[model samples]
Target: RQDPTEEIQNKREEDLNKKKKKSAPKSSYSSVLIDKDQEPTQSVI
Candidate 1:
């Protein structure tokens, strides 16, 4: 019999990795915004 649990765990890990890749850019964007908030003059000056 195949070990379905291993396959399921692998699939979950793959999904989590995909989510992290997709969200990584978003977090970078938010960080830029946060920095802008802290240094609006630098960003707009």
Candidate 2:
């Protein structure tokens, strides 16, 4: 049987990985700033 604490730790690591992937690249402040700078001339379809 798996230890309950080990299962919880694995679940937490998986959640953190998902969060990191979702928050990569454009989620960085530099990309956000660039998008803001371009907003004046860009339109969303």
Q: Candidate 1: worst 10 consecutive residues by lDDT?
A: 36-45
Model 2, 8-44: lDDT tens digits are 9999999997887687844544555676876543334
TM-score of predicted structure 1: 0.49
TM-score, per-candidate, Cα-based: 0.49, 0.53
Over 1-45, each residue of candidate 1 has an lDDT whose tens digit, in order, gives 659999999999999978876879666556777876664333422
Candidate 2 whole-model C-alpha lDDT, 0 to 1 = 0.69
lDDT of 2 at 4: 100
